[model samples]
Target: MKKNVVIGFLGTQMDAGKRRKWRPSVQLCEHPDFPVERFELLHDARWRSLAGKIKAAIQSVSPGTEVLLNEINIDNPWDFEQVYGALFDFAQNYGFDDEREQYHVHLTTGTHVAQICWFLLAESRHVPAKLVQTGPPRNNTPDIGTLQVIDLDLSKYNALQQRFERVSGEYNTLLKGGIETRNPVFNALIERMEVVVSNSDAPLLLVGPTGTGKSDLAARLYELKLQRRRIKGRLVHVNCSTLQGERAMSTLFGHRRGAMAGAQSERGGLLKEADGGVLFLDEIDELGLDEQAMILHAVESGKYFPLGSDYEVTSRFHLIAGASRDLAGLVAQGKFRADLYARLNLWTFRLPALRERPEDIAPNLEYEFEKVGKMLGNQVAFNADALPAYLRFATDPSTPWPGNFRDLGASVQRMCTLSPRGRVTLPMVQDEIATLQRIWKDAHADADAVLLAEVLGEGAAQIDLFDQAQLASAIRICRESKSLSAAGRRLFAVSRLEKKSRNDADRLRKYLEKFGLDWAQLVQ
Candidate 1:
């Protein structure tokens, strides 16, 4: 017969000072008289708390069972060394038990901090311990054994490892080519694209602020499909904004020799170039109404006539279009064709702004550092302080980032080039931050005051003396103001009034100094 398994649950709290307090609860299966003496306790504060609870539970269940207790405090970095000292001390003082012990741990903490720390401690010491958790009971019963303990799933771990490898590989490839991943928005966008590409064959529409890497995603998706053998053709990228009138039609539809003044011979258009592959049209909304009609026809019926030619050509390719503005909004204004809008809107992915995902900052920073290092031919690392500043800068809800990722990449490259000895230091980071803050202040000083006053009360107007914290507060206010301003004329008028506040030369100068803004840039 198999022995019944038991699970022990533990919880702990850590103070601001990093001191730990452990609270434990244990539940068991059959075999109440099983000797608790077979179990050994690790000496960390958290484990000690767990051990105390386990001991109490054993005493309640079976009073005669004997157990040994060990105490360890891991409050600092040096505590690991002390743990080793304690282990050696234990070996020197008490001889090892002849019989190996069977131990089970059921961690019930909502956060993974203690559990991960405990896991590291166990692994470092080569101790064999089973980890467990108390999930919802499978069956509804008071005594039906709701506890669960199992080995960690290595396959999930391996999958995550593979994901990180791919991310790192891409980071290195982009970095080597002098690109930076400063926007956290791209990570989420990539995940979204992966799902979109895998699940649907419909044309994908990438929409976001300008410079948010719509074209980049298009190229990457094309490459990704090729790698997976999902598509047979290459990715053909074209900037629709660059093609206008006759030029736009000729470039998109192809032309024969002597088709136009510049045409010396027959040439294939982007549609033919991307046959069986993907045709990525950037700034698709910029295509004139006529051009949009032509593209829409081609998209609807894979057929188009070449410029200066009467014969129609058949084309088949995946269509991926991108725009910096909302196509629906453009349609409402009659600037974009409704039919083209309907076609592209079949599948759409909206990329979030950079300020949305703060957690992605570290990874992006690491990626940027590696990129800069490769470019400069020297190892570069962000100072510990630099990350926090970068996050604060990137995530400020008020900063418009009109250029998005392109702007951020340029900023990071500038920081790397300006850093002393190729190492980003706290002061260097601060200086860059000061410069950025100033630029932002000067650019939006008027708009900031108007928006700030509206959201934060009229008192906000009188409190323009800015610090990093205050600037952050003002940014939040500005974002809210922009949203509210969209409602009606009164609010719009308020925004106009706010814009005027920054125009006061003396007030603007003080505002610039307080926020570390460059007044000349603002004036210009």
Candidate 2:
């Protein structure tokens, strides 16, 4: 068995009481559980005599134990920095032989500041020892004292582990802007994102359709990093789509005076501005190949040559790229550099589109309304019936939310802006529904027009764009169904429930006749 060694501070006051018979260091040496074969006592230069008395008492109580005194000089034992530095230097230079001896740091005899420093050093493994705390004999009993050994490894403690888990959950909630998302996939994504953000400084690629909160998530992540002191500089956001040609180079990499035509002054680029911070590149897929190459170089090496400058500039910045388009597909098409894609592909998170997560629509709707209220400096709310009516339409499968969250946010803003007395009534919701339906219809009109031409050939030109969506949908449904009644029932699933006759075939026939087409002709 290895010999046991105890290292501690000599309590100048506590060890030298009025009688000077009982001392914490002596108690540690005499404790049966500790089996201390050696005691290394730390003391200030002014406390040499007191330390000598404590060392002699320890040796007298435990004759087999050897005592060594270490002098640690600090102006104030209560000064945290000085105490910590002294303890740190002592631990660094102390020749500890782990193979031959077991070490324990006694925490009973030092200033509170010194004790805290010892705990920090031990917990961080700077001391490579267990902590031993001693208490005086209770009721003047003829006992040496009470002794407790504490291991600083936090993983062994259940309460600390639970607290860490709770903190991680809070981080996930904060990442979602405090909205309790109901979608399991989205919740899981946020949880993983929180872990990634907490542990990594690598470039992050946020892949999702536009209006799915990529930019907002990136900004929130930057804010979290700022709060954690991981970043000391500002978040520099750049929309790659807005940059083009030489201007793109100059804007991203900066320009020197007279480096190129129309260049008059020295410029520090966005990368340099992002030093010690984060660079959020939105719509990064829009960047040209040459710019992509430079970005890869800068990301990999943190060094780049500015526009028309032969000298290299260095900017250490964390990167986060947002892409609405499939960068892998772009790479396959030779539009994006494969090497750069490889770098960013390491940590890729795809945000689900708003339409994909309908369960989130209600809560997000409330959040958007709150945001609009703050922005407008007044609160707006929907009437009881109007709120459900709008929610029903918004969450419907047939609703085309082409712009995702942006579409919903804009719709809410419009309703709030036009609401009478800050209350959105049923009529206003009905009108807004019609407006949104019209907008989506117009947005899909071109695609519908193509399908109409395929069905009608020369006759397609006669149909207006406004009617093409409805007519094309009808034609496509008629072509897909085995009969006109099946097609009509599907197209009027809800409306037919209200009709007593339910003669969907007749209704469908008349609708087709209005468009100068029959079910047979559509299927043919």
In model 1, the runs with Cα more than 4 Å from the true position are 1-192, 396-400, 441-524
TM-score of each: 0.50, 0.67
Clash-forming residue pairs, model 1? 43-71, 43-72, 438-516, 438-517, 450-498
Q: Candidate 2 on 1-524: residue-level lDDT in tens?
A: 99999899988777887544567888888777568898999988999998888888878889989999999998999999999999999999998899999899999888999889989998888999999988877886556777899988888999999999998887887789988789989998988888888888999999999999999899999987877778899999999999999999999999999988999998999999999999999999999999999999999999999987889999999999999999998896689999999999999999998888999999999999999999998899989899999989999988879899999999999999997499999999999999988998777666776888887888989887788889988887888788988999889999989989999999999988987888778887
Q: Which parts of model 2 are misplaced by more than 4 Å?
A: 1-27, 32-130, 133-148, 153-166, 446-524
Q: How much lDDT does candidate 1 score?
A: 0.61
Q: Lowest summed-lDDT stretch of 10 residues in model 1?
A: 14-23
lDDT of 2: 0.90
The top-ranked prediction according to lDDT is: 2
Error of 1 at 237 (Å): 1.3
